[model samples]
Target: MDDDDDLTLNLFTPAIKKNVGKSLENVIWGNRQQRIKARKLLKLTARAKPTKTPTLSESQSDVYTEKSEIANNKKRKIADVSLDFDNNKRRNDGSGNVSSTPTKKLKDSLHFSSLFNSNPEIPTIDVKPVECIKEEVFSSDSFESLSLDTYMLRNLRETMKFNQMTHVQEQAIPPILNGSDALVKSQTGSGKTLAYAIPIIHALQAVRPKICRGDGVFAIVILPTRELALQSYEVFRALVKPYQWIVPGCTIGGEKRKAEKARVRKGINVLLGTPGRLADHVIHTKSLHLFKLRYLIIDEADRLFEMGFEKDVKLIIDCIKEKTLKKQTVLLSATLTNGVERLAGMSLESPVRIDVSQDETTCAVTPKIDLHINTRDNSNECSAFSVPDKLKQLFVVTPCKLRLVSLVALIADKCVLAFKKSKMIVFLSTQDSVEFLHKLFSNLFKENDSVSCMNALLSDQQQDIRKSKCLVTFYKLHGNMDQKDRTLTFTKFSTCKNGILLCTDIAARGLHLNNIQWIVQYTTPGDAKEYIHRVGRTARAGAQGNSLLFLMPSETEYVKTLSNMKINMKEIMMRNVLHNLLLLFEKLPKILENDRRPPRTYEEAATTLQIYIEKVVNDEPEMQEVAKKAFQSFVRCYSTYPKHLKSIFHIKYLHLGHLAKSFGLRDAPGGFSAGKNPIQSKKKHFYKQHPCLEIHNPKEYVKKPLSSFYEFASGH
Candidate 1:
């Protein structure tokens, strides 16, 4: 029954009240959507109550009006946030002009004094528009033209012997010297190191007194690989050595952490190191400080981001500046990827992008990378473009088993007979191949009497640079070997006038070994970029060279992909493709027919694919999320084949496919589901009900101490 009706009936009679209360059960609220939880019945007083009116003071009226204005300002501030979002979206999209009229009145009325006077906890943040790059830039020619200091010019002319400037150097140096963030893209070995190094040297000289051999680093240059970091450190050392006080340091993997920490703590003015090792010191050890850091140069920037060092890089960037410090960031790379662009957006503030490595002018992938993909499908699709004019490409198509023999005969015809005491580097895809080929060549030299590749350099003018003249025909190098062994092999290879160095991709970068007449590819590399670096090892510094790729018949399909990208290779036969050298095919050993496809078990195929995926993960951590996409892309071409392309690849049961499921790529089979990730709630632990731990002490710890040590000792 309704309470109001029951009260009305109670004022009448008991008999009538029961009937009225039962009838009131059908009564409804004002609206269906709105329901009252409690209803009260009003009663008519017998006598009228006295009425009173109260008046407020003048101060009370003023305070009430002030509170009203603050509430209105809060409403206005909210409107500004939305307006800014819309304006930023339009600006980013390049849709059209944005009218600042929407925010003009609110910004004009903005008064920090009013907001802060009412509430002290509220903060004031200045909203800044997105910064954009300048339209034009200037370039410098010689050291004299750059307006560098006297000492720097002296070093440039006398010590470095640098007379003329390269295109990238002339253009990139001026802006960087002016303390503006810069993004530079140029080809490998295009004097990119010197371009950045000159400006860094100039800046360090200006801040020389402040730079000491203790406390924190002033400048940091991050690289992708350990070898590159070490190489960069060498360049930095040369520049810093002339100036005694300006010390430079390096921290990379494969070093003692305790030593690195001590070095960083002692102080370094300019630092060069790998991202992973640098990140460890800054974050975990807390030894390396970037407090006074003014310059940050990210060399090989594209690879650094691709190798999934973004998180670590950003963490280090955050530690550089607290509020007012402005860090000048410089990014350099051969090819600018989308990741590099995104990195610019995040870190670089209105950076000047100086791109000198245009395809027509610079040829970043110069003497272009020779690519050859051998898909099972016969359908050929490719990009049509001409190869680099200077590069001479030759090929030897052979079965799986005959490759070793073909290499021997080709070397005999090309290097020994035609060009005596010529330098060559054979790039194999794996260490195993390098080891196997080194042995195969040795055996064939003994077996064949007419042709000899051994001890051919004994009579040559250039003796082995090493103390011992072993008279070996070739030296082997790969990552599996110790650092000491690798360095020895590289030194021997670089100095030798006529010898072969069989190695993998470890020799592909930073180590400039000129006078390399030929590059023999044992197999196609993993990708187009890899192909460039591999072939790029040769034809360097404007030198004319030849690259011969040894491919299986099916692998020739990769040519179309390369051709599409303007990397057209001229196919030459095994019989003296270099018109100068005559073929020694007749004297070569008889070849035995072997299986056309690679012989691998299901487990072997899966394991190999897994290893490749792991390598990719080191460069791309986000791939772990979309692993299923990667798997589907690989397996799509092989799905239709009946024997699964001669059992070389086990597509359905790939190890990558199994690993993908763990990274939220798919649901487990048989109705198994992944557990929900634990998410902490936003409700903060407030001290409204709970007493503070500091204030509330336990009774046990409140006990009094003994009067003296002697009494305690006696009691015990």
Candidate 2:
């Protein structure tokens, strides 16, 4: 039955006992019969009796114990051997038996001691922050204070009433009023331009002596952007305007060369322009002699480096070095990064740095910017059929033009802001989409919808055509235009109410518009800085604005950084009001002349109206496909339009829509849609195009030098 029971039955069997006894009987004991019986009996008695205990000597007992210990040690060794044997048995049988003893493979495991203790390297990093040089106040009356020229005083009073003295102005002015070499770190819009203007004016007024080439340009303000130069020039001109005798002229890009040459030839006290233009005049043209130039100002110092104008700035500075009078250099900037500080050190000798941290006095009225971060399981998956439902207005940014155009087609009766060249360049994914879109709009309106494309490659005439149409303008801006012209155009387009202005980052900073209702990123920016500047254009002036980013999953880091900045965006969805609105308008005729029902109010609209709008308008299969694609692009771009009756499209009497209606257009469409842009349409174009680029040959235009007495003075 079982192994143990079988063993027991075999051991105590009667048959085994009988066989043993018979064997014993057969085997007589020692020698004779009697002896054999005795032997037999003895054997039987031995088998039946217990063995006697043997007495041993003390030494024998010790030997016995020693032998017992040796036996026990041998037994233990046998047990260890048995373990080894079992391990081998397991290996042979293919059974897994993990070894208890620890064994580290040198190649696989890293030791902490070896990693940390051997060949240790201590890394060193620089942790010092840039320091600002302290400035001391000077008595305003330390030097003879003549009743400032009545005209300059009036302008100064007005400026003081509107704006307070900036940190640069507060400290540097006394030195400038006293005539000192002052290097500064005040940024744009910080009044650095006015600081030097005031001192130059004071010096000009103090002396009534005749000026000559030996005296050079009295005051030269060097700037990187034509806009900034113009701004500075205008400020300087206004300060000295009460006294028309002190004529101050500005030479910048985008102007008639002949007109600028004529103005420079007439002689002025001050000159303002970019480095290249100013340098060309100084080196080739002898019109404005720099030999007598007393004051030199470099504005927006950091911007000079950023725009790759350092070499130009340096060259201009070198040209002025040849002047007869030792010039005083004043450098101004906002953030004195290491590179800029180094540039300053190289440009100015023993200069003082004045940093005015943003304090209570600075304007803090910029619109309240709130960032939202969307948290949902649908984080990365936006349905293709959903439009940006959370967004009222939206902009989509993309690196691919065809993608952008194709996206526009699916969204229904929406205006487009497209790049001109790319409109013609065929997209790999959506070939002929642009032309198709053009045809679609044209057919809808019985002619091409007033739509425009703008880029830097188009001709001025072409741009004008687009602008004049006021419905849509196709345009381009080349590198040739002056900075002022560029800035103005950017501002005009950005604030065009319902118009779309497609542009590059050149229009990003120092330009804010209230009318830019949405921002779109067609593609994710490669870095964080570019992203910040792009979204910055909208959501300006405290108005509720939205931005959309179309990005891939691989761009999670970029999305994270944007989220960290508090930009709340959801994956695009098609079930949105904006998407539905586009479909409705696309199917509806352009005008319903007698349907005079006031547009639905935001309150009257159903809370879930945006979703219903999508369902009702996208009822058609073909239109649904387009809606799906549009929503895909919208989600990729990070925009949303809410679905609800709370807000509806209504006609208004202002901005882009109003202008469009005035120009023979009908009611404004619902949601964030483009209206006619009026830039190229305005009568201002009738005048000779404003000189947007000023290229001066220095030989023709030069400014008169200020008096030496005032230039050398120590205080105001």
Best by lDDT, which number? 1
Which regions of candidate 1 fall more than 4 Å away from where they truly are?
1-140, 208-210, 321-324, 359-389, 413-420, 439-473, 577-716
In model 1, what are the clashing residue pairs, if there are any? 214-266, 214-267, 306-619, 307-619, 372-558, 373-558, 383-563, 383-564, 384-564
Model 1 residue 468 lDDT score: 29
CA deviation > 4 Å runs, candidate 2: 1-150, 156-178, 186-192, 208-216, 253-259, 358-501, 509-553, 559-716
Tell me how far candidate 1 lies from the true structure as C-alpha RMSD in angstroms.
Answer: 33.6
> For model 2, where is the 10-residue window of minimal lDDT?
707-716
lDDT of 1 by residue, 1-716 (tens): 45444333232433322322342334323332111211211111111111121432345534533454455456555654233221232222122323122223432432111100111121122222222211111234676887787877777678767666766788788888988888887655556777788788788777735566774777888877665676677777776656778888888765777888888778788888877777777777666666678788888775655455766677666666552287888888766655566665556776777776442222121121122221222112211212223556665654432343346545765566554556788986555456655644543333223223555554544333322232237888776665456657766777777778887666665556648888888755534454555676666545677888875544555554454445646665533432221233223221111211221332222222222223333335454333333233223222222231333222232222122222223222222122221112121221111121121233421331211100000000
Give a tens-digit lDDT track for model 2, residues 1-716: 44333322322344322323442433323244433343333333223331222333445434544554455455544443123211122111122322111112222221111101111122222222222222222223311243345656656666534233544566567666666666564433335666678888877766667443234368788776554565567677777655555667777656555777667777767888877677666676667766667777887665455555666666777777766447777777644544455446544655555654322122111122121221222212211111112222232222111122223332232343222211110111111222222323333323223343534467877656543442333222223334455656554654454444444333333334445545555444333333544565554322344565543222333433444433434444322323333333323323222332322432122112222223322344554444333332222222111111012211121133322121111212222222332224443431122121121332221221111101010100
Residue 238 alpha-carbon offset, candidate 2, angstroms: 2.6
lDDT of 1: 0.51
Q: What are the Cα lDDT values of the candidates?
A: 0.51, 0.41
Measured by TM-score, the strongest candidate is 1
